[model samples]
Target: MRNINLVLMLLCTTLPVALSLIDGLVPNGDFEEGPKPSQMNGSEVVDPHSIPHWELSGFVEYIKSGQTQGDMILPVPKGHFALRLGNEASIKTKLQVAKGQFYSLSFGIARTCAQQERLNLSITPDIEGKGWGMLPMQTMYSTEGWDSFSWGFFAANNEVELVFYHPQAEEDEACGPIIDVVALKSLSLPKTTTDLLKNGNFEEGPYIFPDTNWGTLVPSNIENDHSPLMGWMVESLKAVRYIDSDHFVVPEGKRAVELVAGRESVIAQIVKTVPGKTYDLEFYVGDAKNLCEGSMLIEVFASNSTFYVPYESKAQGGSKLVLLRFKAANDRTRIRFLSSYYHRKSDFSGSLCGPVVDDVKLVSSILHA
Candidate 1:
């Protein structure tokens, strides 16, 4: 009875802390809390630690909703405040994370002045030297003027500092990207099942902001090892949008990935296979039903088989299943998927859209025999 009571007490205290890490945003991540008047020199933050719960350096500006730079009004993705990182500017916050665990950092970003802007993100105490990533802002996928992006990292220590830095030294100090709603979510290592591929259901991924309709974009060339979308490598020059069924049509389950950049957006995985063994790779190709209308084509590459699946999206939610049977020629086989054409919403939102790939499964042919 004493041991059981002690165990109950421990669970009662630790359970909330674990749940809070998964559900709650980082302290003032949305930047809804503003700095005092003394911290301001016009729009530029005068004090490095003026902002609550955040440390800043270089030319960081505290921006409010409806604030204008010239004739352009800066839009905040959520809440009334956002932070702008100017030339070589950066904002950082410390997090208490479980050591050796994987976490995904999701944040909203919008370009203000520079057309070729990009954000440098890193988590320090990086033992493996793979804790940093660069996300390009050259393309705007949503017409909402801002998009949320996610990057995954392995925690090297119990406490880590998450930093977002703008590396550009533009002529205008204020010319940079606006950021808001920074969130961190713990990711479980996807388990391999009867399916040859891990995370084949596209169920595990970065956190999605509930208030925003646009899904999180996983940056290009993300490796399978540290990808925000677990077990899949984004192997193209352009990022792939991770959509949720809450805001967009998902072919199956609650989540899926949209290949929005045509051939430029690709997701792939490598699976161990027995030589001369036959396997069947299956997936669903569909539209997100977010006003994306057209003939969408998805190309699937597996071992020694290549297949093209065409989907005619009438802007209504629907999906078609595709299968590719192949014989494994090596001990390992590479499986990849890419859209053959790019598309935008028919609503003239200029928002990039494409076929969603989900419910992917790969199994040995003998399993069906």
Candidate 2:
């Protein structure tokens, strides 16, 4: 009596494959995309008869013929995880569910650059640290294309997470977030299974407060010396490549952030304390026309041992994505990336070329999840 049906697909790599299929992994090795088994006639994808509630980690890579937004090309967790990145396509997957059963989350995206593709669609709340919080479960956008779009969320938490906000435009083409579908099914509590994660009824698009997401998801740098926190892109306490020049060479043990180039690097870093409690040291600041233009707001004082944050130079590149609410005796101190607290104390200038920080995520000033 556990027919937990799950259908994961994004087909069209040109095949004759078919079915409610399930099971696929290899998230990313970059093998062309989808449709294999000698090239066509099905060599895979076809194992679903409803029996998986949810379980898909990340990267399985596949996008043959290219229509799907590749990432777990086949890791079947049908209980739900659609998010093809609609503004879609850069690759993202996150989950942490576990409740009394009944899961169904959804968010089908589509983007070509609907006016700069602000594709900045955000709504966070899968937070799990403040007295039972699960207040976000809303999203469904896809007007039609490849006719790929589907949404259906109703979770009580076996777990939950699906954050994919895209805005790395310069010519764009992470291609086809064109999700074909997203699934999740588990319902059998005629009396106690009705909260389907209640209060998550949909409709709350626009709360980017996660430090503005820094230039959104960058590339095309101009340089304020770099620091939309560069997603905490660190290195150089000893140096070798961690030599972190311009700070956007990402690849040191991943928490994940990709957007590189040279000429304006520094990008902040520091989080080795938790004394007297006063945390909320957010990060963000972007600008670029060829090298800085506008935006840079700083505030990191752990006893006034250091401070710096001045970014201004713009034709395009945005994010002060700021958020600093402090009160501390010491969190172990340190949060810097040059600007050197105006070095001389305050005449700090501009054009250091920065802007590009991805999910440096740290919300525990008092614990929200």
Candidate 3:
């Protein structure tokens, strides 16, 4: 009788304490979490200390357990740390709490390609591209060391694949470096979670241009990742439908826009944009053919008059990525793609043409409420 009484007293004493502990772990005030492990990524990644507690899911290849350089590392100084990769691939993870909200994303990343390869990264549209956007990888991660590449975008959907790509492949000495991690961080800012999406919007594209075919084209059918197979051209279109078999590419010397013309089709919504805010933009222009010249123009702040913004040099010569940032108004802002821009001053004619967009990000540190 005494023993039974003691057991009952102990249970009664610990119940309230246990409940209090669980209450602290519930997300959004939902169900609580039980006990958790002390740490995650026990041995798979490098400098295990850099990575905190995360449940990682990855597609690893050519990974040797004993190799540290070929694994995922963590928390590079805001913008200081950099490493070199040698024929490897991997991605770290974070439990996305704001699963359906759009976030302003920025990170410094690059790869060392001995020849014509590039670094790559990819992601699945969880909730249909809902919370983030990225550019197709093409920057040459030269054999000399590494390069810096970045992009920005609004998440168009959910349940999507997330991937990374590394440039250069052919002349890789023994093995080409996949990519070196710089930093992956989400800036802190206020954004409308509800106002960003419309009718389950999506980034449905892989619109391969038949103009240049150095390799097989992988459409959205491939997992949302930077697969090696996507070596050729890749494009992303919001709220779109793609057909790979009949995809069109502009022919050499016969220049024309692969315009998905019509207002509703070409324009992308500026989700959660405040009336007065500044943002940066970038896209590519390049030789998609042997002797063809192509480029693009971005239309912004146009009050019915198609605004013409052209690509300027920062990297590759004529057709390359151009970046511009400006204050945006609270009202609806229109964005469009213009095929050609004519210089009336000298009668100079040039058009922006490139396989894919690199960075279309909007970011600001000082924001007004």
Candidate 4:
């Protein structure tokens, strides 16, 4: 019967892709699977469904590693292939996810020809009012020519479509960024602890690809509800770098945040407090040991109290503990941290780097005394 065949086709198309919604890379996320020869017109992908586990539109090209475009060799972050999205081009995929849960999408991108490249991300059917976000790519955080970025959103349905679109159309149809390593991970809500702050240890966050050493960037102005850093909010104009112990030096736990954008990068969280109570805010400040050498300053603010902790970095990895005593002015307190100056690698790599913050804790002074 025609009805039976229609049902069978749908199951075959989606079942394989829906297997693991847990952590790690999505199916064919690295673009290791290439399109058939019949589906290609030179480097440009002719068929929309040629790339397995993905759909393409507009002027998308399937680029192999070391391919040349006007003497510029296209570099793939990890695998042998990557997708180049030309002007007005886009690539997307569908997956099964738990409804009402928060998720973060991680991917790597390299600017090829576009001077001002940015991408638009959207999910459907639209769930939480604004099911879309536009990430600005003007700032290059990593010196490796490409940077990994993460975006967080809540899933409103059992199945949702995730899309990455290049909104600006350049003069040349092929002028755009090459994107690879598209990954998705569900975030468990951070639990409250005795530290007076949620996720203060920086343990839970967006998924990091095991193959890459360069940490992921959590974009700026991301609110707490849609932040990849769990309970913290990126309240500045530039993004904050999320580093892991496997690749970079961590001050405390397995994960930490580097305020690489100087004053433009800020992380903050709101916490409940007792009015007129004195508390001690304790945390660790260190370098990621990425050859970033300079005099670093970490500015911290808690309600009416403000303090600056200074650290002299010789490039090698080291950490210092700082304690700030402050009085809570109201029932709620706002805590914030930012780097005072921008820093780059002393090894002449031109990579952005800064101080690392971890193991942040706040407790009543009398309790510890």
Query: Best-fitting candidate, measured by lDDT?
Result: 1
Q: Which ranges in model 1 have alpha carbons more than 4 Å from their true place?
A: 1-20, 127-129, 222-225
Runs of candidate 3 with Cα error greater than 4 angstroms are: 1-80, 130-369
> Per-residue lDDT for 1-369 in model 1, tens only?
999999999998666446536744788999988889888999899899988889999999989999998899998989999999999999998887777878888889999887889888888865565778787888998888899988888878778988999999999988899999999898898886898899988899999999668999998754323788999999998889999999998989999999999999999999999998889888888888899888888888877778888889998888988877889899999999999998999988899989999999999996547
For model 2, how does the per-residue alpha-carbon lDDT over 238-336 read when each residue is reduced to its tens digit? 100111213222222222221122222233335555566655655443332233333443433433444455655343434345555555456555554
TM-scores, one per candidate: 0.93, 0.25, 0.32, 0.92
**Tens digits of lDDT, candidate 4, 131-200:** 7777777888887778898888788877888888998888899888889998888888888677898888
True lDDT of residue 6, candidate 1 = 100
Ranking by lDDT: 1, 4, 3, 2
Q: Pick the candidate with the highest TM-score.
A: 1
Candidate 4 runs further than 4 Å off = 1-18, 125-129, 222-225, 367-369
Q: How far is candidate 4 from the true structure (C-alpha RMSD, Å)?
A: 4.1
Each candidate: RMSD: 2.8, 17.7, 17.2, 4.1
Residue 229 CA error for candidate 2 (Å)? 12
Candidate number that wins on TM-score, 1 or 2: 1
lDDT of all predictions, in order shown?
Answer: 0.87, 0.29, 0.31, 0.86
User: 2 or 3, which is superior by TM-score?
Assistant: 3
Poorest lDDT segment (10 consecutive residues) of candidate 1: 15-24
